[model samples]
Target: MTIQSSYPYYLANRAVDANRDLEVIDKHTGEVATRVALADDAVVDRAIAAAVEATPAMARLPAHRRRDVLNGCADRFVERFDELAEILLVEGGKVIKDARGEVQRLIDTFRIAAEEATRIGGEVLPMDIAERSEGVLGFWKRVPIGPVSFITPFNFPYNLVAHKIAPAIAAGCPFILKPAEKTPIGALVLGEILAEFDLPEGAFSILPVPREDAARFTEDERLKLMSFTGSDKVGWMLKGKAGKKPVVMELGGNAACLVDADADLDDAVERLVFGGFYQAGQSCISVQRVLVHDAIYDALTERLVEQVGALRGGDPRDPETFVGPLISEDDAKRVVQWIEEAEAAGARRLVGGERDGAVVRPALLDRVPDDCKLFSEEVFGPAMILERFDDFDAALDRINRSRYGLQAGLFIRDIGKIRRAWDRLEVGGVIINDVPSFRVDHMPYGGVKDSGLGREGIKFAIEDMTEIRLLAIREA
Candidate 1:
């Protein structure tokens, strides 16, 4: 399950043994795990040119062939499941169990894309609505939008990369992907699998380039669309530089979960614990705020503290470990400082704020100030804030106070309250009786406001990667 000493970058479906200047660290041990070749500006320009050149071949690729390519990728991923999970655990710092789950999601995403490849259908349009349109027939179908560019983050590397690559393959769009520098192994391995297929030359390239050199990915006029998943600051900056091409972004969020008086306390406690701390709470939709009704606030807080304290933190390779290290020591230090700042500002630290190197124990705080970073910004670590709410409407309003509107969760027995939250919540999706971290591979997933633009499920991404054209006929 160990990775090779060095891996090469892929350009135009061929492996280029360029100099391995970029070193990838094993997050758990803080040791250099492997090195990957880095793509420079010249290489990037060549990749974009290749993608532009291969645009027609990819567009003319039959639907059945596209489905076969995706299906083959799924099969290969299943065959090498353990290897992929191990890479995720070492390079991405995910616990072994969560790493395996992400691998399964990667497979599911490709399978879903395979199914959707053949389903990219067109519709007949009746164009005789007016007298001028008499004897006119029309139809419309989606076509590949040509070369696209993708920039993915380190968290959930496999599945997030799948969300971009799988749909591009399904919609017959050639693309270039620049994976996060912290974690490029998973995407490079995927390039190996993709090269096995007889895809059109220059159909895809997996590059691990420095952030400074990746500006071309956003500014290149040949690239038809740009897809980015990372911090809101960087996503918006790239959008401004993306020129005339369309941009799809899945930026981070500080999601909230509300617990009503009548909700199941046991179920709420269990889900909240997992939602707030899973994978060190690095996900964009990880539950960062828990709004509990006053009647059950004390009880839920007690139970949650016990569970959060009991979570194991150590080597991610251990099967018993639940809490793992953050991506780096600096990130762990940042989380610790934020917690200390909140405590100094009159917030109460309930449990688990200890830190050792990159591993920060899961933390829970009460009465966190609205202006504190922990409460207002995307923590992107294993920390959550607890708040008490008496009125349901006030609680909903509190959740809306933040600039982020990704997703929110509600645990309630009353159907009326569920409907109210559904209507009142400003997020993109509301989960009833569950945590906001819940997501299926096929579900349309994205956020509003500062959380970024556009949906990212396979079908939704396909729509973004393709353009519709109308075929019309007029009878003389």
Candidate 2:
């Protein structure tokens, strides 16, 4: 079942194969769908050096040419959109529809990067403050920070990686990418498409290296910046070892959604269900916690139970399958363990809590204890904890109790309460009437506290990969 290309990876615009390979497992059946060649430490060094060697050409490439390359990449992605979606289903375990959405996002990300390529500029500043400086002028525009190193997570193998790759291209920065071992196919295919472009040789590399063997990508001082999108534990550890180079971290979060007394009950339940279970709840901003005001708690709970109970769970290839298997059976069991422990601690399991193979049916629990693993940590599973609160202040305090503060959702129609949420929430972005999972490609998206550092949208990423360089001239 070699559904993807056979090339091990793309390095310096050439396909390279390695002696060792890692099994790419299909989460549904726990079967090896394909094998991806693993990069050795020497391969890692060569990839980085290739990117470094290409830096000068990439940096000097005109913005128009960069824009054309990015647009060309987007065109190539559209041509193989269905193929990439199927690869995402096989290697990433995403349902068909969700997989297609990821593919579309990949296209959109690159298109946005193409649009931004020509817009990279800085404002002119007046330098004639004194008589001696009357004929002087000063201005600054953004320039490529040089080569970039990116390590993307597996959950969103296509779109998340695009957030890193497309921006680097727009800014004319050579980048070395290390995709997650479990889901490296989409990235490798992306690298293949890029290789067909007129990009300078050694512009980029996409290799799958085990986390333990990835120090060359992280600790190397030659790379100007490193953009990491993954769990907090690993992301932070890599940041510490990344030397003095600027680092961007897109770490995990345990996001929450609040339903107030005056909110639209019907709308709130529908959106929350989607948010809590979408992508099997693997998103960093998934709705892990739901705080409902006591006034509408019972009604919302009934609706939520009905909604979550009806979601279909099964194979990733199934179009109707609303929930698919976790990345592995161990991950599914972890979700199950958390739900069972919460139930033992006196939490009421209002709905599903059974697991078959790697698929854990959507589990909805109310009155879960504050100390439960599901409550304190990022579950990354199809489970959501609901709690009832009387006062809004107390609810805000509860929301802020956790270390992670990526994003939070509030459904408040009242002006005062809406203003309060906007003013007081500690998260990066607040959703007015929707769940925290709501993210558009253009908006600046990131978090505070333990969730991570820096924003990841296309334009924002261009900002991270480029810095201002000022040039001043004086008439003699």
Candidate 3:
């Protein structure tokens, strides 16, 4: 059955067939609820026009006023949390309980961004470089960069969308949000909520367009920035298309989590199970590879095997379910293929190499060869390959060997060893004594190397979104 909201989900340009134009697919039941108008070049042009027209008014709104607008939306979102959670469950294949948490994360992201709005300020710089202008007073003002275009991904649609949308509004920049086509409803509802706050007609726009048309939205010269979160390949391509436009791209992560000899194996195991298998390992920061010290490798693997073996896999709506289906049946088949390739190339699936419908039990592998695709590529599914290392340096070496270095986790008690790992690990964020999956709403979250550029979260992203204009004055 196609689920329809009693209210219209699309905002701004009143196009009736938005639902059909976008082909919004239901990940759980694999059905199309409504065709969301896939923003074509023309729709993108209109959205851009709307945003550009709204930019001046948005910027004129005092930061405190902007906070009020954002907080209003956040309040509505929290009040109707259940409705948003259901949309996440049906559209993203997230289990009911996890789906609810996803909605809460979005709410938290908005609340944080709202608070950050009033805190946007610039610094003063002394004109010491110019001897003639030494007596001049110099200061700087932080202002919005006009219109911003947010292209969010399917995973964590609500929260990630909030990451982009909330900050854009808080920074006094009008936005045109293009949510992932598959999970557009929740984002659309968010835009609708912001609209309820009597925001200027063009303050923000959300269009559920397909991937092919996303570039068209960025093609407009008025789009001052493009904030995106998705796969590395696509993020890079978008960065290139964005030209000189500021781009905040949060890309893929084939993250490594190291378990050292001087660590807590039980805590590491528990966090890994939650991080790796939760969301069916579709998370970018999920523990894709674990580099365990040889001293505790066998013991760690045994506990991991037991924990993974006991996981429940099935209907996402069940609160007790440990694992849910992949985003789609095709994705499930692809994940199976990835595991099969790893096995054929000399990797051993220690447990759970089974699939029923879109649901696949989490699979753990050991002795995965360096030449295997599972080791070399981003296995963005519910499977993590295990590698054994004998020394601290060796573990660090193995962890840094992968091209994607978004975030890394190390379980260690030795301060010296932890410091050494921190020095050597080439990642944007590192978690000591915790798994890589741990991320708070306000932290500077992004990756190094092929993981893309810039950062997310309200504060850092706001810094990237605006340009500073220094002002100097001297008495005549």
Pairs in steric clash, model 1: none
TM-score of each: 0.99, 0.97, 0.96
lDDT of 3 by residue, 1-476 (tens): 22563224344524334434456666766776555555575677777888889888888898888888778888898888887887777788889878988888888888898899999987787876777887788899788898898888888888888888888888888888888766777777776677677566677778876666667666678899988888888888777777778788888878899888878888889998887888998889988899888898899999999999999988788888978888778788888888898899888999986888788899999988887777888877899889888878877887889888899998888888878887888999889988899899999999888887898889988887777888888858
lDDT of 2 at 77: 86
Clashing pairs in 3: 18-35, 18-36, 18-37, 19-34, 19-35, 19-36, 20-35, 22-36
Q: Which number leads on TM-score?
A: 1
Clashes of each: 0, 0, 8
Candidate 1 stretches with Cα past 4 Å from truth are none
Q: List candidate 3 segments past 4 Å from native.
A: 1-19, 128-130
Model 2 global lDDT (CA atoms, 0 to 1): 0.90
What digit string (tens of lDDT, one per residue) describes model 1 on residues 272-389?
9999999998999999999999999999999999999999998999999998999999999999999999999999999998999899999999999999999999999999999999
lDDT, candidate 2, 88-193, per-residue tens? 8888889998999999998998899999999998989899998988899899889899989999998999888999999999999999999998889889989889
Q: Which candidate order results from sorting by TM-score in descending order? A: 1, 2, 3
Residue runs of model 2 more than 4 Å from their true location after superposition: 129-135
Give per-residue lDDT, candidate 2, residue 451.
88
TM-score of 1: 0.99
